[model samples]
Target: MNSNKDIWVFGDYRNYFQNRVTLQILARAVDLFSTTGSSVCAVVFGRDVDEYVAEYIAHGAQKVYVMDDPALNTYSIETYSWLMSHLVKLYKPETLLVGATRFGQEIAPRVAKKLKTGLTADCIDLELDEKGRLVQIAPSFGGNLIAKIITPVQRPQMATIRPGTFQELPHDYDAKGEVICLPVPEDLPKDAIRLITSERRPSEKQKIEDADIVICGGRGMGSKGKFKKLFELAELMNAEVGATRPVVYSEWASHDSLVGQAGKNIKPKILLSFGISGAIQHTSALMGADFIIAVNKNPNATMMKMADLAIVADANQMCLGIIKAIKEKIRT
Candidate 1:
């Protein structure tokens, strides 16, 4: 296997549904290494995976490796990681990308350990250096600075990228690729944990991470009623509402709306911050946005320093003003 010619992506699927996040990261990887002669390949593991190989090819995977088995119908940390390690050994790919999802968090470290390679987690960007090695860029020191990491001695350089950080390429249905089906190991672990049940709960009213525009309120909103006005503004803009960790911990908003290092990492096109002090944890998560507009009474807040535009005003008043402005614009 040529070290500089093949890149592998862990094609993540859930309950027979293909994860678009994998395609998004693959697109970015293609962009990062296009000048080099490297081709992208996706390794998928699931039951009835043949039906999904075309989807990965359409997203720029030159080849799709399928490891299908009934035991993989639901994710088992030990089973999936073991399978991935086997595939990596077989392919000897130079780079491996995985989505930074719950499953990814569980599986990537285990695979890295098995392969004895470095794994960079939650990477926002990727690039290639002069020597044709990958440069994984992720937040460091609580998002105060972006760190670029390289795997000099690792055989398969591995990184887990955050979803929404990469743009998915336009699909080409006419794209063609080879699908190799690998047999599951016959000597399966008899005591392997089997999935007992699966259920889907009603999703949250808003997924702030997926929202294109987010209006976040902080403790400075003063009261619950004022926070309600922030929701009104979000409604008028057809945006999702978010909150700083302090606001959520204070019961000003639900934990679902918390946006920070410990909360959901968002990469919205526009992030509007209200009444929240930009703590390192919160700022680290939102720094990936295209545009940041922060509103706070304090001029010296950390968030204000990093914002593209800053408004020095009370949180409630700003929310009300924005709601009125949006309503007026709609009427016109």
Candidate 2:
């Protein structure tokens, strides 16, 4: 094993804090690279971001590399990619794990091309194989087959990792780690996609990924009018609403609310599905749910067979019944 072969983590920021996805990626990296005596180095860049260094260290990075400068204040693909490429050439890391976020997805490929290395995107699983090579597992061929990708010849095997694919490491308040501030590359072009103005979108109170109880619909939901029932159900239980790919494609739900191989992987405490036929693409994402309760008209549906509790009935009628019963109970 190469001693210089370190695991570099891209600590992507959101709302002035380290994104949960970045912490999730570093946690897995720390576990895998620790066996090889490889340093888990987290790279964070922003203006006045000294606050995040300790948090990253608490999440399992042995070394937190900070590049705090006004020039790195706002995120730009051009500047970030050039700087990341510089770090790779200078430090010669063995593996680089990036959060497969909107920002990360756009930047990872650019940096990979700059460094002339292979990059695997949106990996659901990552492990070091018997040969000490990085193995990236992800879905391929329209979510029909699982593909294992490896970069044997690339110096640093790079991967863009999805959140909720792995559990985050617990914070060790008593743990002590190093924080080394790295100087920003001076050669970065100033004219690289200059930002004129920016506006922030209002945040949602709830999202499927963060919900403890999620109620998702599928093609069997029948129509958009019926699809609104999921919202009423969610309100009754204070649960978040998710949907299968078909439901999302049909515009019954937004893409962010989609739970499947092609969408978000949610690990709710209670995952309740209605009228879902249990396609493999949809079922795979529910592996992390604590409890799965399925209701479908068809008793032989795949989701029903795999559910912890399967109710054979009319999904719409059942949903209305539950809502009615709850309201009546409240009145009493």
Candidate 3:
């Protein structure tokens, strides 16, 4: 086994262009390298995936290991877990980071079990401890409190990080890195199940995490009828709608639009918060918003304090006024 420690990021290229979680995790691994003095590497398995390897290098990977074979063309949890466990045994990486996508959530735990190492899921942040162990920060007790956890005796500590938690580094065309091509192992396991065919449906709207402008509503919107106005405002402003947990539970919004520690993390350029009291669970997720405009009846609400511009007024009245103003502007 190699004596030097390495930080490995799983390269998920199924939606390379649209899903940027892999690049974001690679950027975070590079940042950790400064602290651990470990080599930053990416591992990928897919056919015709050379472009993704180059992209990873451009984004700060010091080295890339690729197994580009036709047999590995599509994603198979069985094949992936087997291959990943094999690689870890050979290279002995100190830490492994995977994106908390559906694919990753399935494969990471399997690999961790095969290696008998601890695995943390849906981590919001990661930092190294004084002993150089990876400290995983995740929500606990239904998102009320934050928990920091560590694996005391596990090799290649593993964690699945939420998407949008970290930003990716800028692409550098001039950057160079080593690419190690590996042949498929002769004993690669056959998948228990075979894929026949797959179909992808087009998305009808933008995901809340990727929105440039977000209009968020809380319980103070009074009633579901009043909350519906946020959708009107969103359409007029060309923005996406987000909701607090209480609003979602009240059936005013879908779970997809829920934003908080237990839900999606958004970093829109501009965020408009209405009637939210600024619970820690909700505010922590939107900390990355470039600018915030908050409206609430209580001037001392936590949300109001955190906003760049705070308005003390009835949320429904303010929402109606904004909608009317926008309509008049459109007429002129």
Q: On residues 91-134, what C-alpha lDDT tens digit does candidate 3 reach at each position? A: 89988999999989999999999999989899999998888888
Residue 84, candidate 2: alpha-carbon lDDT: 87
Ranking by lDDT: 3, 2, 1
Q: Name the candidate, 2 or 3, with the larger TM-score value.
A: 3
- lDDT for position 89 in model 1: 82
280 Cα displacement, candidate 1 (Å): 53
Q: List the residue pairs that clash in candidate 1.
A: none
TM for candidate 3 is: 0.61
| TM-score against native, each model | 0.59, 0.61, 0.61
Q: Give the number of the best model, judged by TM-score.
A: 3
Q: Write the per-residue lDDT of candidate 2 for residues 45-132, one digit (tens) a residue.
A: 8888765677678778898878898888887888888888888888888888898988889999998898888998999999888988
Q: Judging by lDDT against the true structure, name the best candidate.
A: 3
Residue 122 C-alpha lDDT in model 2: 91
Q: Which stretches of candidate 2 lie over 4 Å from their true place?
A: 1-3, 16-18, 204-332
